[model samples]
Target: MFKDRLRATRISKKYTAQQVADYLDTGLRNYQKYESGDARPTFEGLVSLADLLNVPTDFLLERDEYLDALGVSVDVSLECPPRRPKPRKSH
Candidate 1:
């Protein structure tokens, strides 16, 4: 599920696998394996990829059934408001 969505999102964004690999600071082979579902990315790696692609993590995860119910298309490249960090409590 993630593999298919990753490939589709990359293609939709007009990004080559090599380009994505470079962005993620990973080898071409490793990135290819990711797209092929032979390997999965770590949580940090997924966050990095999502940042590089300007997408929400959920978009790459392809778990947008709720969005679909609301008639929203799951296109990750769309520009969204910057995420605000949670407030930290003072000691």
Candidate 2:
């Protein structure tokens, strides 16, 4: 499910395997392995891919069932907290 969803989203977004590899700074062969399900992405890599695909990380992990089990609604519109400004150094 993870492999299929990842491939579908990538294709839907019109990204080639090489494009995804370049975007993630991963090797083409390694990225291909991910799509083939011969390899799984690390936690950080999964997050990066999800961000690039504009999908939830859980979606990539095929964890929607877990979300359903918890009765947690998925809302992608939740805004991230704004970055706090760096403190100015006193001269």
Candidate 3:
């Protein structure tokens, strides 16, 4: 569950696995294993990942679905303020 969420969140933010691995200060292989669901990170790693992913550790643990829904609302914004056009030049 954490693996899936991590991969999805990373991809959504246009980050490669290597980038995340670098952020975690772990080998790319280890990061790949996490994403493959073959292993889990240590407590520190989990917290670090949650911080990097901008999600709570509980979300990575899939402890609450409500959090996931709430995260979707906050992590990816739906709208941006409109930009006003520059004033036209006078003749």
**Cα deviation in Å at residue 81, candidate 3?**
30
Task: Identify the runs in model 3 with alpha carbons over 4 angstroms from their true place.
Answer: 66-91
- In terms of lDDT, model 1 sits at 0.79
- Residue-by-residue lDDT tens digits, candidate 3, 1-91: 6777777767766778899999999999899889778889999999998888787787667666676566543363323334345469999
lDDT of each: 0.79, 0.78, 0.76
Task: Tell me which residue pairs clash in candidate 1.
Answer: none
Query: Positional deviation of 3 in candidate 1, in angstroms?
Result: 0.4
TM-score of each: 0.72, 0.69, 0.69
Task: Select the stronger candidate by lDDT from 1 and 2.
Answer: 1
| Model 1 error, position 32 (Å) | 0.3
